[model samples]
Target: MGRIVRVISKDASVVCSAIDGKDIVSRIEEIHKTSAVVTAALGRLAMGTSLMGFGLKGKDDSITVKMDGDGPTGALICVSDSMGNVKAYVQNPVVELPLNDKGKLDVRGAVGSNGTLSVVKDMGLKEPYCGQVPIVSGEIAEDITNYLAVSEQVPSVCALGVLVNPDLTVNCAGGFLIQLLPFAPESAIDQIEKNINGMESVTKLICGGMTTEAIAMKALEGLEPNVLDDFEVNYRCNCSRERVENALISLGRAELEDLSKDGGTDVECHFCDKKYHFTPEEILGLIKE
Candidate 1:
């Protein structure tokens, strides 16, 4: 499990959500067996969406982050509940790429610069709120900042990163997001800018054994920051046999019969490669509308 900490500046003009998601990211890598580059790419995206999830106000609220880039890794989708529980699907989890010019994992190469990053939030409303922004750098953090600025009209500072081991295991993964409320003063903005420019990297901080609380405090170095709340979340999937059967039933009785004539049904979950098999009679039993 990983922890998320919610912090508010002493003046309440700014708020931040900090996460230490190494454990959850490690679970994702194990489940997907992602290549080193894919591991870093998906790890950063998952951490970003997990922070978004922790920001939801409603208990049933959820958020989905989607990216379709012009790279070998294709599309990446991640879903998270209000509590920060998250699951993700990678279209190409085995993509291999050389290090970038700076000797860092080429996340931008795996996720090309051409595409869009879309965020949809279901706040238990009639329709979810949707926002989209063109991918600025395909480096997760920059794209998140662009989306918040252009689509939501919120001036935000975001830092997301993942450290991957040579064997493709995740060494550490985490992110922090801070937003300036409308009432934020000029001095506050200046202070934040200075702190952000002076702070250590989020991945470096996490790898050095900093907790989510410490990271949030570090981000709010100049401002009077207070820890408002904290909670833990993990990587988990909600797929089940009943859901698989319902999916088969949605295909129509004629199609079910046609498929049953050949063999049974094999349903596999994309988020967590859990497989479910049904016999011919079982597929026939799913004839209900």
Candidate 2:
């Protein structure tokens, strides 16, 4: 299990949320069997999406973050519920590329800058809210930062990192999101900027034995930070055989009739690779219903 913490400045000038998602990312890698570069790219995206989902106010509210880039990784999608349970997958999980000039995993090369980053929020409303922004950088962190600033009108700083071991396992993965509340004082803004500039990458801090609360405090240093709440998060998919059956039932009588003639079929979930098998009798029953 991973941990997530929410912190706020004493003066209420800033709010920051941080997460240590190493375990979550590890589970994702295990399920997706992603290559090194794809692991880093998808890991960062999942962490960022979890942080955003943690801020939802309603119990049933959910968010989906999608990166439709022109890079080799193709489109990456992550869905998170209000409680910070996230499930993510990449279109091309095995795509690999040479490290960039920085001698780091080529996340940018794997997730190209030529596409759009879109977010959809389901808040139990008639119509879900959607936000879209041009991918500022192929790096997932900058793209999220840009989405918040442009689409949400909130000045924010998002930092995400994932360190993959030589054997393609996750070493550490985490991130922090700091947003300036409305009418934030100039002094607090400057201090937050200075603290971020001086701090190391989030993965380094986690690898160095820093917890989510400690990372949150580090981001809000010099501002009298206080932890509001903390909780455990995991890479959980709510998919089940029943849900898959219902989805197949929605395909209408014509589609069900055709499927019933096929003897049997296996349906694989996108988020989790769990397969649900439906026999001809099951399909015929659905068609009759």
Candidate 3:
């Protein structure tokens, strides 16, 4: 199973999370046949959401990651939870782009530099906690790092990457996040920054078969972190046929009757590329209950 590791760096006085999305990301790349741009974008989205999702305390808690981009890739959304379950989809998974000036996947060009990145945390409260920030860079990792620092007031460094082969298959995908603890010393912050700037590419590290815990330890070498927990992360979706039927029933009695006359209804889950078809009788039964 793919794993996510959380560690506390005693020297930097910070908490860090690293993920090797080997299994989950490979499966998604195979299923979507995503273009290079889409692969990079979705890969980063999955990594970022996984970090945030596992930060919650409750098993029932969940987090939603939404990026409304203005380029060919359109919008991207992902949902994840403390259990390390994540599901994500892109509005246009076929968007293609030439490599950027750096000779890398043109994620920014495909996602556009203008948009909003929002995170909603569902902590069993009636109202979810939401934080929104304007996209500083459509490069994903930077955008999310800014969102956490500016919007959430957490000093964080994020690195997310996807390596796609010429054959349009994923070679590797993963991410890492390092955050400073409250009132960390300036020297500690400087050392952490230096470590981040000197670090090797995250994708390369994962492709070399580095585990999540090893990555975290490598990144914070000078910090000497203590591993807190390790969790298995997978691509999981909560949508079901029953949930779709309940939604149709909630459309009201008139809508149910009209659907009965029309035969049935079709509903699609945005988080996963799954379609649920409901018969008129199913809708009526849901409404009666």
Candidate 4:
């Protein structure tokens, strides 16, 4: 099971996750038959979303992370809820790109750096909060970290990792978020920088059998980290036929009439590749209500 760990130290608060998601990402690749490079790009976004999503304080609260870039990967979108459930979809899932200078997946090439990262949070309020920041790097983690620092006015260190195997399945995936509290001292910042500089790759740690808590402990060097919460996260989609039906009804009479000329309408859920069909008779029934 994939697990998200929330912890706190005297100087800071952190969220770390070691998601066992080979099966989940495999299903995603199967759904889209994403190229290895695209899979890495999408997988990193999924990991980053879960780390942010599990921070919602309410049961119905949710967060969406979206990036509109100039690259062929189109837009990357992920929706996550307070319960640690997440779903992801890409506008163009089959983007292919050459490796970067590091001989790693060229995520920045797949998702151009000259774009914007937008975050929307719904907290069961009359109006949700929205923040946008220029894509500092299309590397997922750095972009999100930059978003928090610039848009939210919070200093955060975020790292995300996704390792795609030769067969295009995710081998392991994980991430960690370290936020410096307002009252944190300068020593705390310097200490963390030293720790991070000496630390190893997070996904590699999870691959080598380290738990999320251990990673959290490694992040907080001088301060003692206390595990506050632990829960399972998943690539879960809440889409259903009822939601599709409601959406169809929202199209109004004119749109429904035009759709009826085509005999039927086929709508596919972006989050999950589920397709829903509505016949002309159904459209007529929906418009009447």
Predicted model with the maximum lDDT = 2
Runs of candidate 3 with Cα error greater than 4 angstroms are none
Q: Please state the error at residue 108 of candidate 2 in Å.
A: 0.5
Residues 1-289 of candidate 1 have per-residue lDDT tens digits of 8999989999999999999989888988999989998888888899899988888999989999998899899999999999999999899989988899999999999999999999999998889999988999999988998899999988999899899998778899999999889999999899888989988899888898999998888788778899998998899787899888888888998999987887886788999999998888998888885
Give the range where candidate 1 is weakest over 10 consecutive residues by summed lDDT: 258-267
Q: How accurate is candidate 1 locally (lDDT)?
A: 0.90
Residue 80, model 3: lDDT of 90
lDDT of 2 by residue, 114-168 (tens): 9999999999999999999999899999999999999999999999999999999
Output the worst ten-in-a-row residue range by lDDT, candidate 4.
11-20
* Weakest ten-residue segment in model 3 by summed lDDT: 22-31
RMSD of each: 1.2, 1.0, 1.8, 1.8
**Using Cα atoms with residue i matched to residue i, what is each candidate's TM-score against the true structure?**
0.96, 0.98, 0.94, 0.94
How would you encode candidate 3's per-residue C-alpha lDDT over 1-289 as one tens digit per residue? 5689999877547888998776666666765667777888888888789888887899899999999978898888888988768888888889867889998988898888999999999999989999999988899999989999998898988998888788877788888888887877887787777887887899888888887888888777777789988888898888888787777767888878888777887888876668887788876777664
Residue-level lDDT tens digits of model 4 in 4-116 = 78777764443333344445566668777788888877877877777787777999999999999888999989888986678888888887677889988899999899989
lDDT of each: 0.90, 0.94, 0.83, 0.81
Q: Candidate 2: lDDT of 89?
A: 88
Please list all clashing residue pairs in model 3, or write none if there are none: none
* Clashes per candidate, residues 3 or more apart or on different chains: 0, 0, 0, 0
Ranking by TM-score: 2, 1, 3, 4
Q: Rank the candidates by lDDT, best first.
A: 2, 1, 3, 4
